[model samples]
Target: MRMSIGRRLSLLIASQLILAALGIMTSIVAFRRLTHETAYLRHYVFEPFVVISSGIESSNALFDLLARPSSDVAYDARRPMMELRSFVEQYQRDWLTATSTLPEALHLRAALDRAGELGLLNEELAAVDTIAAVVASLERTTGLVGPAPTAPFLRRADVEDLGAALAKLNKINLRYMDVAYSAYDRNRRLILLAFLSVCLAGVAAASLFGLAVHRAIVPRVRRMVTAVQRFRELGTYEPLGDWGNDELAVLAHTLNTSFKAIAERDKDRDRFLAVAAHELKTPLTTMKGFSQVALNQRHDAAVRDRALAIIDRQATRLARLVQDLLWCARISGGERPFNPQAIDVQELARRVIGEIEPVASDHSIRLMPRGDAHILGDPELLEQALWSLLVQAVSVALEHEPVLMTIDADSAGRELITIEVRGGKDLPEDLDRLLEPFAVIAFEGRRGEPRGTGIGLHLVQGIARLHGARFSIERRPGDIMVFSLELRR
Candidate 1:
């Protein structure tokens, strides 16, 4: 589905935020696990070992008192025996409690089972109690304790046995510590691996997403910018393709549309200038030629008079061209003011025919009025339009082919004024293009080059538009062409 630019950006941002949130949640969970591991080691591993070590130290002291006792050592051994018993009891309670919390510590659990099988903590407590009983017996007064108990009460063998038992349990505790520490290390490593995995996955996902976003948006934006830059430098550009139904695509479409219009208008302006130059050059050439003749042939009054008249005629033609050009400019710029009034259609048609009659002596000009007609229009502009249309007709009409002008109402009995001029000559193959400015239809003339400014029909079209009239052209085989102008009455 096509998403708009705003929605797409929002989705991208939302995705990034979701990824970040996931990363943060992973971190929090990892940290929680790390904290739990820390507590597990303290309670299950380190603290239990502390209690076991203290018990072992006290047991060694107890063994010393029993094996070789001076009076001072004997007095101190009493305190050590009490401490050994208390330490052993504490170690037993804590070890069992700590083991319950660390179910996943496989080696630690195994070592705990081994300690229990060895009768480990029980043997240590038993030895401490037995030696206390022997010491109690040695201290009693039986006729002053039967010669002050000269031999050591507990034998070296018994002491050795107690030490061996203590040593065995110590070994078990050491093994348990090793297993617990290893478990802790593995736990740390697992947590670290998990954290790193989450981070790597998040980073990779973000990278892929970033690349996708860049591909979707950046290249399209770059293309539009490049197109605009090229247009700026050269006043021309190729259109951008539709990337999607996004804002940037719409922008690209709008720019292409505007540039196309500007290019077409530029083309029309160039064509107009060329045609205008040609029209001006022809009249200026004729005026220059006749003026020179009048100046050089001063002695001949007849020749000078004829040259002046010809010059005056050409000058008038140039003036009319200027007026038409100005009117075209005003209409195009929307500066031409409209003033409509009731006008006699027949009178205007007759005026156009009379004006063209002088130069159109070779071809007959006729006007057929079906009924008297009137229309609301700008009289001057309407008359100028009709004049241009008649002249254009006269230029293409064969000498023997009469140019006909008609004024009448259309089919619905609705009042309409129409002027139709037909010529024996054929129009250009592209009839529609012929309406464009500077478009001239090539037709052979019996005289010199056919007199056409190429601006007449274009100017006529503009004038028709200003008066809200319709202009059309029809042609038949053998180049029998007809031009029609329809106006509402």
Candidate 2:
């Protein structure tokens, strides 16, 4: 299907916007996931490990106090027991706070509990509490007022058990930290990869779209440019092939139409020149031959006078031909000025009949006036047009036949005046061609020579047009050819 330039550009823009939106949305989703994972590691993984390590240190300190030999062992153990109890309470608070802040951490804790890791850590914490209880009992039994006692209250086995529990707890925390760190790193890499992939896809799509647009526009534009250049150089039109329904296609069509019209006009111009040369040459040749005979001293007076008369007639014909050529040129160049005034159509027809009747001796000229009709026109141009039409009618009419010039108001109730020249002979089938400059309707005169310079009808048409009148030719029922001029009243 055909797409306009505007629609194609709109589609390109829309595609780019859609791709950009998709990229932005992908980035937002990936970033959101990364942020969530970060919070998960901080609360459930790193924070919990810190609290476990602190608990292990507090356990070690208690064991150290138990290992020392002292005169008042209970008094020394009292401070370590209080510190261990405080550490245990603080560890529990920290763990609770971390787990409570993130829902994902709570789920992780539940999973760890199912795996026995959380339970093992809890058991180790309970052991530390038991050791603190033993130290408390010793302090209660050996009062501060008693004499210095050297007996150690915490046994070697108890210390060993406490160390083992703390070690196990630390090991569990380390393993959990490792797992959390691995996952965090993996998720971050995945997010980064996804964002990069989305960006790459957008870039690829944009590149493809750019290439598509270039292919759609560039080749056709180049073709049109090439066609124009070829026409400029060769004076010939080359058709740009069908390029679908686009702006370029429409332009190509217009150029094709204009080029064809120019070509036709050129043909017409060449034809006009050929015909004009023939018409001008004939009259000039006649004048030249007769003038040569007239100038010869060997010629008698009667023969010389006859030759002079023929020369004068040819000159007059040549002059008329020249005048018609000039009028055609002026009309075509838009150089003819129109001076409109009300002119009686009947009176104009009579003047044109009088001018044409003397020359057309073989044919009778008649005026059929319907009424006193007046039309607004350039009087001089209108007269010339009427004279030309009458001359054309007289030349084409059969010998001894009447050539009628009819002037009246339009029969169609329109405010128009119509002047018609009717001749005894039928018009050529291609009557319209007679309106073209130097176009002749083939007809033989009494001497078997062609009558009328082809310019007469063409000049009449042009003059009628200058007065904004309609000129037409048609054949009547009796094979009578009629030339009509309809002018606004």
Candidate 3:
């Protein structure tokens, strides 16, 4: 359905807003997922790794102290051993915290070879306590004698067993690191994929919207522009194609209607010019012939008088033609003044019939006055209108046929004065064309008669309109043609 411009714009904006909201929602969800993944990695993987690594460094320091003699040591080994034991305790506490925070469904089992090898996480803490006891015993032994025990004083088997325990703990920490890191890597990949997907979706949506807008608007604008250009250059444009209820479609319909009106006016102007030329040519030709004759026969008085009379007649015709043209112009421009008064329309009809009687010598003219044919109107304009119609009827009347002029009041409730000219001839099919200025009639009734300037009916119609009267023509039975004017009473 067709809609106004405002409605169409609203629809477009609403669609864009909805799309934008979707994009924003997608971005928010993706950002939240990324944030959660980052928090998980820091707590489960990175933070625990840092604590374990610190404990390992502290253990290495204690081992180095044991490898040296006690007399040569610059600092006491007891403090270093105590610090190492404190780090071990801290590592255990941090491991417990890390496990407590781990998700219910761990994604790290694939990274571990055997859960039993490490036992429970608490078992690992017990092994650290055993190492602390061994270190304490060694420290006591060092203080007792023999300038600190030699590096090989501890049994190879005992040292190897302690190293194996540390190795197992280290292996467990590394394996846990491997699992945490794997989970972190996978989380990173998923976040990246989601972000990329959102971006791709936003771009795709934008592209589709742009394409849709272009398709909807560009062609319509182009068609309108082309139509205007053609109208300017060639004075015509093709009819608009089907427009499916957009704002542009309504605009196209309006413009096309105006174009058609302009074309019709242009056609009318051309036809009027041709008809004017023809009307002027006939009188001018007659005047020229008579003037030539009068000039050439200067010696013959009778010939000159006859030529002058013919010239006078032609001049009168020319004058009337000019008068009709001027009246038409005045009426069309609304410059003609009308002064209306109460007048008996029957008397007006009598005056018009008397004026047209001489012109219709071959036909009988009659007046049929009925009722009180009274109307308030301009007497001169009404007379002119009646005269024009009577002359037209007489000109086209069949030989010996009667042209009747009637004046009467409307019998209907609407009080109106009607003037009708009923001619004894069949109405021509082209009545509308006949009413136009300078329209030529080619029917049997007009065959033997000389054509008038063709402005009579046009002028009559104009005068009738000026009097607020309706003018029309109709055919009745018995081959009667009636031209009528119904004036306001």
Candidate 4:
């Protein structure tokens, strides 16, 4: 059967559409995933900076508290105070340079504040010890412990006030530390939540996209591959199904059309080769053999007559090939010359069956015809078609098993007839090619069996085309092979 151009085009369009849709889908999925990943990475980088800034704020408070004398400690307040200042200064510089993501660092900008309550209490402890020592010195020298020398009114009121001020600084540090840690903890959770959401979204989207791709696109592409394989190995054309109206579908359709067309063209080439070979083989064999025999023998009258007879037979074979070639050319050139007449297809099959019955019996084959069918077609051409089929059936039948040809009308007087031709159980893998002319299985240097020019079926195909019918060959179980002929008027 001929595949129409419009159908081919639809298939092509469908294939391209399928491919394009899949490409677009993949790009979308990749882009989304990349964007989400980038955001996740950026969030990860900013978390460290917030942590370091909080450390700098705590160190500065300790430095200021040591600068004052507290009348409490035996240690030298001046030297300790200088060391504290140096440490605070170093820490302050570290704060300016530290690379931390902690939010508290951004919030706590000011520096060099006064000492806290702990510093004041420590200063008081130093001053009290110093006073006790001073009183002891006076008692030892002057036998009096009455509040050492001058600055006497500098009393405990001084230490108490300094302690109160220090307490306030400690409270400030505690408050800011609480705020900073709280912000960091909350922000950390927020970042964690964001990342989790992004990851989940990416996973979900990937799965959805994968499902879409497998469901809508992969099978269509796989079908194109299967179709190609079947065409190459089996000489069969299978149409690619819809992948949807999407780009992938279009691609699948287009590829299917290409594969089918390619298979058909290949089949045509094989057919032409087989038919041409088979048809040419017979006449060449006869002509060569007769000419060589005649040349080798003395030309006696009887021998001459026999030579002429053989030559004539070969000439007839040549004529048949030439006629087939011409007929094929005409058909190709659109010279379809089948004029429909009211005729019975069943009658034609019966007639052809009768003509070939003796041939079938000679081969020990059974040829049966059964059906009630009428068709508006060229009876001569149609009969020839049936005859050609029966001849091949008898050729393939074995010595003992009878070949059976069954014909039955299909549905509503539609003139549907199936000729089930039974023959050898073993069929050639290249069965269709076998129908061609000189493609017979000949010995290396001799004439082959089933002698005839192979144009018989070529003629049948051309005539069927002229009548706008469809012809196909298929195999059945055992030794049965069937030819399906659909004739429509």
Q: Per-residue lDDT for 163-196 in model 1, tens only?
A: 5655665665565566566666777788778778
Taking all chains together, each candidate's TM-score versus the true structure is 0.55, 0.64, 0.57, 0.36
* Candidate 1: residue 272 lDDT (0-100): 64
Q: Candidate 3, residues 319-348: lDDT per residue as tens digits?
A: 666777888778878998999898887777
Task: In candidate 2, list every pair of residues with a backbone clash.
Answer: none
- Scored by lDDT, model 2 comes in at 0.68
> TM-score order of candidates, best first?
2, 3, 1, 4
Sliding window of 10 residues with minimal summed lDDT for model 4 = 109-118
Residue 380 displacement in candidate 1 (angstroms)? 3.0
lDDT of 2 at 147: 58
Query: Who is ahead in TM-score, 2 or 3?
Result: 2
lDDT of each: 0.67, 0.68, 0.64, 0.52
Q: Positional deviation of 161 in candidate 2, in angstroms?
A: 9.4
Query: TM-score: which candidate is best?
Result: 2
Model 2 lDDT, residue 49, Cα:
64
Clashes of 3: 0
Cα lDDT, model 4, residue 247: 70
